[model samples]
Target: MTKPANTQLTDARRGDARADRTTFLWTAAFIFAGMTVTILSAATELQRANSAFPVGKVVLYEITGFLSFLAMFPLIAWLVTRSTPGQHSWRQVIPVHLAASLGVVILHVSLFVLLRKALVPVFFGEPYFFTDNLARDFIYEYRKSVLAYGIVLFAITFGRELEQKRRELAAAREDAKKSHRLTLKCGGRSIFVDASDVIWAKSASNYVEVKTPGAEHLARATLASIERQLGDAGANAVRVHRSWIVNADYISRIEPTGEGDLKIEMKDGATVPGSRRYRGNLNLS
Candidate 1:
């Protein structure tokens, strides 16, 4: 019994460890991709100043960029994961990008002596000291380019993503509004109804019987206008039958009950039939 229990516990622990690894990889990839774009933008800007394209200078810049990208990994990971809002919102990405850009420049400055020394052998047959003339201009230009381009790249990429998220949020809010429940009281009577909550409504000349939640309501509203309102909310408030508008959120279990009958079990313990014509609406939602 103890051996079996230990085996099960070990398996569960391994599963949890794997999940953590996956999460870390995803976070790291997002950070790395952003940094790559920033670095590449800097390279593009340097390329545009093509008149001063020094082979030695470009080679030296490549080495510095490689090292900066490597150092930026841990810096970005720390900034994004350490903050509370960073873990949940896009706000974390802004700080991470700033830190990454700063880290690249700072690391270049701190390791200038060593980087220059290493590049001497790569660009020239013989190794040279950091005090050489070749190291001076290359280091100066490299630092200037990294700062200017890194910010540009981060702003463009991050701004695009932020705008995309904002649009998605706006669309979701519009959808929620269409299906949202509203409560109103008039003449000592309280009424609560959602546009999508109405399963069916019938015209009684001047009054309408609105079927919703778990009861029927007599409200003074036009069915045509209500249908148009649901459309503004989202595709979820689609009309199944001419008289019925069902809330897709309440649908829990859907199954075929017979040759031509389909049963939908709702979260509120209500049963609604899914007709052949309405099956297309279910797919839309």
Candidate 2:
């Protein structure tokens, strides 16, 4: 049975919400793991160099830096989504991402500096100063920030593409399962119609008239809904008029009406009018 259009839309929204939640959780886990590794590595380097800085201070510094990037992560993701990677040329995408990367670097530096100034004094009883020279600090941070931005953009683009492919595969499997038959409730009786056996269908008031080689069935459904069912069933059906949908396999010949319309002749010896507006839908060749 075909679901109502509104119901299908609701289901799609629910699926999207669930996918979003899954992506968020996975991203958070990876970020946390990376932060832990980075902090430990930085602490080890300080120990190897015999630096005067405490391990706790090094960890705090790394945490603040990671937190700054974490704060800016959503904006990077939003920019990537807005860019619609594969849809636009590199010429268009490159400039937007470059400008966004600059913005991210500036924001990240400012955020982490502020965090360290606020938290360091409380923990160690001493003030924190990022640098005396702002220009040098920005240039130093810019390189790392750009690299981080690129990594994140690539990850998001790859994830979205993978999700799209997964959805397409699932849809193909579902269509395969329902491709052979259509269930219709007519006159308080349930009727099963083979998709291949359908010749044509027409909208009658609020209902649709489904025609098969063996029988005609009137079902309480809209022509648009019937068209969707036919498509999902993999039937070679095309809507040639506002009120008519004909199976291309049953169409023997198409005659020009000379009024910018067509007379469609079916193999079953039935005729249906085809609107000129829908002529592009037919494979005339």
Candidate 1: clashing pairs of residues: 178-233
lDDT of 2 at 87: 66
lDDT of each: 0.54, 0.81
Error of 1 at 151 (Å): 6.8
- Model 2 Cα lDDT, one tens digit per residue, 138-199: 99999987997887777667666656545544554365456666666588675778778889
Candidate 2's C-alpha runs over 4 A off are: 1-23, 181-285
Residue-wise lDDT of candidate 1 within 95-161, one digit each (tens)?
A: 6555565655556555655776677677766674544565675667557745643543433334334
Segments of candidate 1 deviating more than 4 angstroms: 1-56, 84-105, 126-285
Q: Tell me each candidate's TM-score.
A: 0.32, 0.56
